[model samples]
Target: MKGFLEDANYSIGLLDEGATLADIIDNCIYEHTHTGKRAFYVGDLGKLVKKNTQWQNVMAPIKPFYPVKCNSTPGVLEILGTLGIGFACSNKSEMVLVQDLGISPENIIYTSPCKQASQIKYAAKTGINIMTCDSDIELKKIARSHPNAKLLLHIATEDITADEEMNMKFGTTLKNCRHLMECAKEFGIQIVGVKFHISSTCKDLQTYIHAISDARCVFDMAEEFGFKMNILDIGGGFTGSELQLEEVNHVIRPLLDVYFPKESGVNVIAEPGCYYVSSAFTLAVNIIAKKTECDKLLPSGVEQARDDEPVFTYYINDGVYGSFASKLSEKLNTTPEVHKKYKEDEPLFTSSLWGPSCDELDQIVENCLLPELSVGDWLIFANMGSGTLGEQSTFNDYQRPLIYYMMSFSDWDEMQDAGIASDTLMKNFFFVPSCIQLGSEDRFSTAA
Candidate 1:
C-alpha cells in the first residue's frame, strides 16, 4: 500500500504539472495494484469554471442556475458552488443535497413542474418558495399546501431540431397560461415569472426567439391581472459547445434587448445542466478481456478466419447498467479512443466493445475500427461529466468506478492562498479524496 501511495503521488504530481491524460493513466496503472475499472479526472472541473466565466461574459444580464440532476458528482457540485452559481433542484432530496452544501434557500429554484404534496410542504418549510408549475391541478395543489409560494409557469416550446424534445413531458401552452395565471390569482398564489425549455440538445436558435416572444404575450397578460412578473426562467437547452452557445447568444441577446430589455426591470435566469459539466469530465475504462471471431471454427468443419477482414470483441468492466446509463437515457453515442497510438501502417481490425455484464444489451460500441488491442489496454472517453456519474448503480453488486478529485495547480494554489482548508472542502462538497492527497502521506499516516 505504501508503494502504491508513492506511485499515486508521482502520477498526481505529473497531472499537476499538466501531463497528458494518457500519460497519467499509464502511470496510475503502473503504480496501483488495485487500480479501479474506471477513473474520473476531477481536474477538468477547471473547464467548467472557464465555461461559466465565458457564459457570464456572453450573457452578462442572464444568470445561470445549474440543474443538479444533470451530474450530481460531489466534486462537480463543489466546484460549481465555489463559483457562486445558483442551483435548480427538481425534488425534495435534490433540494436537501444543495442545502447541505451550505447553499441558501434563496439560491435554489425548484424547477420541477410536478410535485407530490409532501414535497411541496417540505419546500415551504425549508423556505424554498420559488417553484414552477405547468397545470391548473399543480397550481391548486400549491395553493392548498403553500399558498405563499412564488411560481414560474413552465411553458413548453417545441424545437423540431432538438435531439430531445421536453415538450412531450412538461410545459404549459400560451393559450392555457392566462387560465393558470387566473387560477393562481383565485388561490392567492403569486405568479412571479414564465419559464420554458426548448429541450436538451436544442439546435434551433429560433426556438428561443419564439419562446421569448410567447413569454412576452404571457407577461402582458400578467400585467392585466395586476401581477408584477419580474422573472423569466429560460429553461436549459445549452449544449456547452462554444459555437452553438455563441450562435444562441447572438440571436437571443438582440431579441431580449427588444422584448425584455434591462430597463424593463426583469431578471433573466437559465437552468443549465449539461452546459456546465458536460466537457468537464473524462472516463477511463480498461479492457479486461478480448476475443477474435476469426479464431473460431464453423460447424461445417471450416475455420472462421478471413484474410481480408478481422473482427474482434473487447470487454470492459463498466457497462450500460452503470456509467453508460446515459447512452440509453440521453441517446448519447460514446466513442472511445485508445490511450496509446500505433503507427499509420499498423494493421487495424473491425471491433465491437461490450461491457462485462452478462446482459447482451450492454454493448458499448459496434463496428468500429481499432488497432489490435490486448487485455489491460486503456480506453478514454471525453465529454462524460453530464448525466453520467450520478446515475451509476451497484447492479449485480459490481462496484462503481472510483473518482479522483483534482484541480489545476494554479487553482489549488489560489485556494490555499485564500485560506481554504482542503479537508473542509473535500468533506463538505466532494465524496472523493483529492488526487493530491490520495497517494500522499496525509492519506496513509496515522497521525499528523
Candidate 2:
C-alpha cells in the first residue's frame, strides 16, 4: 500500500494496513472523478509477464502465438508483444489491433477460415500472408483474393469431455483438408502447414497427442498431394494454472519432440489466449451486506428453514455481467467458498456473494462454503479480469468493470508516457491520445 495510482479524478498512494476497504474504495472513486479515470496500480505488468513466461517455458519446443482475441487488454498485449510471441487473430479487426501494437506482419497468422475478401486482401497487402482455410471454397476464396498467401489447413479435433474443448467450430476433414490443399495448388496459394485446436481448459493430455497424430496423418495425406508441410499449429489447450507451465512443458515436450521431430523442419505453434493471462490477477471485493433466512415447518414435521439458521448473502461490487462472465459456464453462477482466519471448532460455513448491479441475476457465488464471512470482509475473485473479462464485450446492457492495478505512482507515470497505465489510469485517464493505427499515413510524419 505504498504506490501512487493516477487517473483524471486524482492520484493517490497506498495507505497503511490500518486503512479500511471503504477508504480505498472512496479513493478509487475520487481518483476516477478527478483524472476522469481511475488510477490502477500498474507499476509493472507483473501478473501477465509471470503467466506468459510460464506458458512460454511450458510450450518449449512448441512456440506460442497468443490468440489476440482472448484478452486484448493493452497491458496484456504489450507484455506479450515485448515477449515476441506471434499472434493468432481471427478477424481483420484483430489483425489491425496487432498492427497498431507494432507487431510484425510475419509474426501474425490470420486463422479465421471464413474471412471477407477485404480481410484476405488486407492480410496479404500487409505482408501477413499466413492464413488458415478449412474448405476448398475458402481455399478458392483465398486464392482469388490473395494468390501468394501461405495457408494452414485446419483439421478439426474431436471433442473430448475435458475442460478444454474448442471444437465448437473450425477445421476441415481429412478429405476436405486434402481437397483444400489441392485446390490451393490450383490457385497458387502456399500450403504451408496444418493446425488444430484442443479447446481451452481441456482436462485430458493424451487427446493432444492423438490430435497431433491425427495432424501427422493429415500431413502424410498432404505430402501425398505433393505439399510439404512445415508447421503444425496445435491450437493451445494446456489446462494447468499459470504456475504449472513448466510442469506441463516437462510432460508434453518429450511427447512432441519424439512425435514431431524438429530435424524435419516442421516447427510447432500454439494459440494460447487463456494460458498467458489467467491466474495473473485476483478480483478482491468486500462483503457489503449479509442476509439470513428462517425456515418454517411445512405441512407435517419437516422443517424448511430449520431452527435459527439463516442463508447469508454477501454482496460485492462486481458480477457475471461484467468481468465474471466466464464463471457463468453458460449459466450465471459462482461457486464461492469461505475460509476462516484461524482454525476453529465451528469448521467452515457457506454463503453467496452478489454483485452491486441491480439485476436480479447478478450473483457472483451461488452458495459458497466458507468460514462464516461477515459484512465488510473481503473475498478474492481468483482469475477474474485476466482470464474472463478479456473475452467480454458489451452486451445486454452490461458493461465491463474498470481495471484496478495495484502499483506505485512514478512507475505509473513512466508507463503512461509509454502508452501504458495502471488500472487506475484506466479508471481515470481519458485524455491521453492513443495510437489508433499503425503504419497509417496520418500517424506518421513526412520525411525529406
Candidate 3:
C-alpha cells in the first residue's frame, strides 16, 4: 500500500470509522461539480480483505494465484500481495510488477501460453521458472530461451460450453498432451503439471468434474514418461458469486480427494481474476448530454421497454471504449443508480446511456428505466473493478479516470488481524475524519 502512495499513479483515501463509501463518493461528486465533472472510480479496498477472508473459508487447500491481466490496479496488486497471494503473470511487465513488490520468483508463474521469445528470456534472467505452455512451438521457445523453465502443460479440457470458444484460443487437446509431453522430453523442457480454464459463461459444474478428471489422466500419463506431475491448476471461471463458488467447491472437493489425495504431494491452485476485484470498486460517470423524444420507439437492441413511450438517451463521459470496456465480451451490468436524490413519485422513463464518442457502438447501458436526469447529474455503477481499468481503450483525448482507493478502519484492523503487519503498510494510512460535511443541498443518493 505504501509503495503506491508516493508512486503518483494512485490515490488511496483511508476512511474513518462509520465513514461510509457513499460519503467519500458524495465528497468526490461535490468537488467534481465545483470544478467540472469527469469520470472517476472509487475502489473499496476493504472489499478485497473481505473477499480474501471468504476465499480462505470456502476455497481453502486450493491456493489462489490472481491473474494480473484481469485488473492490474496498483492498489489491488499491493493489497493482494500483502495478503500473500501468488500472482499469475502473462507477460514480462506483469512479472516485473509483482517481483518489484518483493514477491519471490517461485511465488510467480508466467502464464502466457504463447509468450514472446524476449519475454521468455526476461523470465529466465529473473528466475521466473514456472510457466504454462500448450504446444511444441511454445515448448521449443521455452527450451531455447530458458531450458531450466518448469512447464504446466496447458490442456484444453473438452470444451463443453455452448460455443467451445475458449478452448479454441488456448490449451492443447488431451490426445495432444502426450505429443506435448514427448516434445518437452525431446526439447529437455520440464513438464511439471497441467492447467485448464473454464469460461465464466460455462454454467455446468459437471465441466469441473470432467476437467479435473482429464487432469488426472494427464498426471497418470506423466508417470510413464517419468515426469513428476505435481500442480493442478483449475483455472478461472469464478464470477464473484458465493453460491456459485460454494456449489463449484462441493462438486470439486470430493473429486479432488478421489483423484489427487493429500498424500500425492500435489499442489492445487486456481487463477481467479474477477472473483477478487469485481465487487470491490464502483465507477462514477457524469451525464454529459441528454436527448429526449416523445411518442417514439425505443432503441432496437435494449432489453426492457414500452413502445411509443418517452425515451431518453444519456451521453456519459465514459463508455464501452473506456471504463465499461468489459461490455465488448461480456454484458455490462450497467443499470446505474441515480447519483442525485429525487421524489419517489417522480416518473421513470425508458432511457439509453451512451458515450461521448458519438459512435453508435458506444452505448453503455442499452435500456433501463431511469429518473429523467439533468446533464450535470452523476450515475454510479457498482461492481466495476473487474478488469475495467486494464481493458480501457480511451478515445477523443480521454484521460484515464483517477482511481480513489478507500478502506474503512475496521477493514484495516481486519487486514492486520489477517497477519499483514508490515511497518511500511501503516505509513500511508491517511485516515479521514468520520464527520464529513457533504454539502447543503445533496449528500448521497438512495432509493427515492
Candidate 4:
C-alpha cells in the first residue's frame, strides 16, 4: 500500500482503524462539491468543435453526419442539433428522439442497414427520407415498404471498426455494391450515394484513402448505370479523443484531398459518434479493499491478483459489469491509466483490481501496474464510461452521481454573495457513508 500511495502521487495519512470504504466515498463526494472537485468532467464538446473547427475546416471537405448511437445523451444531441450536423440514426426510436429534440428532418440519414420494415416505414412516414442499404434483399425490402424513399448504397471496406459491426451486417462488397446499384435501378428506387466505414481503432494511415478510393469506384459504377450518386456517406469511425485527433487528421486529411475531386459533384459525409463525445468526462471511485500477497509466476500475471504464491487485491466500487463490461468482453487490451493522488514514487507492479460487485468476474483491471492500495482511498478513472464517465451510471446498481459543471469565474461571481461556497465547505472532503460497508461475510461468500 505504501508503494501504491507514492506511485499514484497521493498523500496517505495514518490509517484510521474504525474507518470503512463507504466513509471514504461520502467524504470524497462532500469534498468534491465543496472544494469544487469533479469526479468526472466531460470535455466541452462545443468548445472542442469550435477549436478544431472540424465542421468548418477539416470536416468541411468531408461532411460529418453525427452517429447518435455513440453517446446520444440529450446534452450531446442538443449540441449537435445546434451545429446543424446531420445525424445517423439506426432505428425508429432514434428517429423519434431526433424529432423530439426538434432536429431538422433533412439533417437525418437513417443508416441502419439491417432494419425492420416498421422502422423503414416509420422513417418514410416521419419524413426522415434518407437511408442506407447494402444487399439486394434489404434494398428490396426498403423499396417495397417505402417505394419513394431516397437510399444511399452501403459499400464494405476492410478499413474501419466500431463497437458495432456496420459492414458485416449491412454493407455490400465491392462486387456486391455494383450488384446492389443495379438492383436499385430494377426496383425503380433512387440511389442517391454510397457509404463505408473506417472501423474503430483503425491502425493504418491508408485506411481512409483506400475506403474513399473504393467509394469512388462505386460512384463511377452508379454513373455508368445512369444513376446520379451525389452523397457519399462515409460512416462514423472518426477517432474521438483529442489525444488522437492529430494522428487521425494526419491519416485522414491527405486521403480526402486525394480522392475527393470537387468537380465530381459528390459530397462526402461521415458518421462520427465518438468524435463528438469521447473526451468529455472522467470517473472517480472509492477504494473498497486492499490486500497484499507474495506470489511467483501467476497465470494472469497480475501483481495484485496473481494465482502464484503472492498476490495483492484492490477493490473499487465499480467494475466491468457496470462501467466497462462491454469493452472487457471484447478482450480489448486498452485499459484506463489510474490517476494517482497519494504516493507518486511507489513501485508499480502487476496487480488486479476488482469491482465491488459480488460476482467474481466483476473486475476493472485484470493485470495492471500500480504501487499498492488501501481502503478508503480515492482513484480517478480517466475516459470512464462510453464517453467519459457519463455513459454508464448506476451500472453496479449505484445511483447516478450529481454532474456539476464547475462554475466559471463569471458564474462564481453571480453566486458569490449567496454563500453557496461557504455553506458547502467541509473540513475534509473524503468521506463515505457507513450503511454500505463491505462485510466479511459478503467477501467470503463470493470467494466460495
Q: What is the TM-score of each candidate against the true structure?
A: 0.86, 0.71, 0.91, 0.70
Error of 2 at 226 (Å): 2.9
Please report, as a residue range, the 10-residue window in candidate 4 with the lowest summed lDDT.
1-10
lDDT of each candidate versus the true structure? 0.73, 0.61, 0.83, 0.59
By lDDT rank, best first, the candidates go 3, 1, 2, 4
Best by lDDT: 3
lDDT of 2: 0.61
Clashes of 3: 1
Off by over 4 Å in 1: 1-15, 18-20, 31-43, 162-168, 295-297, 300-308, 413-448
- Give per-residue CA lDDT, model 3, range 1-448, as digits (tens): 2222124345456777867888878887887788668788888988988888889999998999999988887788888999989999988878988898889998999998779999999999999999999888888888999999999988886556555453346888889999988888898888889999988878778889999999999999999999998999999989988888899899999999999999999999999889999999888999989987642444656554555457898999988787877776668754699989999999898899998889878888888998889989999999988878663564887667767788888898888886894665566456577776766343322102
Residue-level lDDT of model 1, residues 27-60, one tens digit each, is 4444333544444333365576578768977877
In angstroms, the error of model 3 at 275 is 0.9
Task: List per-candidate RMSD values in Å.
Answer: 5.0, 9.7, 5.0, 11.6
What local lDDT score does residue 98 receive in model 4, on the 0 to 100 scale?
A: 70
Report the lDDT tens digits of candidate 4 across residue range 299-399: 46645443343457788766665455554545433464554455667667677878777567777677777666667556665444243332354555743
lDDT string, candidate 2, 1-448, tens digits: 2222112133223223343333334444444334333112222244455555466455666778988766666655655676667898988878887787788988999988689999899988898988888888788888888888888888877665644343356777876776676677777778888888876445556667777788878878777778777988978765436544555565557767776787888998888776666554444455656665433323556566434555666666556666666655543222432322456576455577776665677776676666666765556444443345444534454434454433233334544565544453345322211222333442211111
